[model samples]
Target: MANRSWLPYSISGEIVRGFGRGSNELGFPTANYPSSVVDALPDSFECGIYYGWAKVNEYPVYPMVLSLGYNPFYNNTKKTMEIHILHNFSNDLYGSHMTVVMIGFLREEKSFKSTEDLIDAIEQDIAIAKEMLQKAECLRLKESFSYDL
Candidate 1:
């Protein structure tokens, strides 16, 4: 089990282009972080799906799900932090500075039986995250979010 001691860890980084799977294949667009942000995480941090709050370029905070791992499904060798913000945005997010406050862990990364299974898992993660972020404590994080952090 990952150390739950760092449940609300926060990190900031500029969005970068990923493997294009999120939007092109999975239908869920994600704002990816450069390797530096992923490298800065604590040694105890484990790869998994996490629900959190995120804001781009100091915009209003929104619920987010972060996939931090080697993405076994894609057989990726490099680790990544791919964040799927809950709200849809009209503008392209590449190069935008984003800050995320991880609030809770949902599940660890795993390969599915098929692409359909993977898509279903992602959809379920989003739904569970939306419900979890509605709580008073999680709401406080979103409500009190500031780029200053």
Candidate 2:
């Protein structure tokens, strides 16, 4: 874990500012996490697909992608932070506490033939992700429905 101090802010806190950056050229709307919380997180965090929520100005941003795998095509390095925001929702998110809660794993990261191919694969993956989240959401609703009865 990276040794650092806690941020003056907390999760779900208000967004004071925002910025955009393409982490590893993936055009991920990367947000800054307090080094303290970043360090506190388990190092064994999975690198595959996961469901989570991010707070932009303290609003839940669902169906977002949070990646922690090496970009073999871009860089041979491993465990780089990356995330592609879903649903065409784009906004400045710097200096905001974006919390990602891991929900599920899609598949292990791998290389593709070309950038287009990679993008195509990502599109398919997004489809699968939406399906999974939908099912999960349905199950949750069902469970609640049963309880309400």
Off by over 4 Å in 1: 147-149
Pairs of colliding residues, candidate 2: 18-94, 19-94, 49-106, 51-103
Q: Which residue pairs collide, candidate 1?
A: none
lDDT for each residue of candidate 1 in 1-149, tens digit (9 for 90 to 100): 55768888889889999989899888999999999889888888988999999999857888999999998988999889999999999999999999999999999999988989999999999999999999999988877776355
Q: Candidate 1, residue 57: CA error in Å? A: 0.8
Give residue 86's lDDT in candidate 2 (0 to 100): 67
Query: Residue-wise lDDT of candidate 2 within 21-61, one digit each (tens)?
Result: 34343444445444354345556554444434443444534
Per-prediction TM-score: 0.95, 0.62
Per-residue lDDT, model 1, residue 121, is 97
Error of 2 at 142 (Å): 14
| Residue 72 accuracy (lDDT) in model 2 | 57
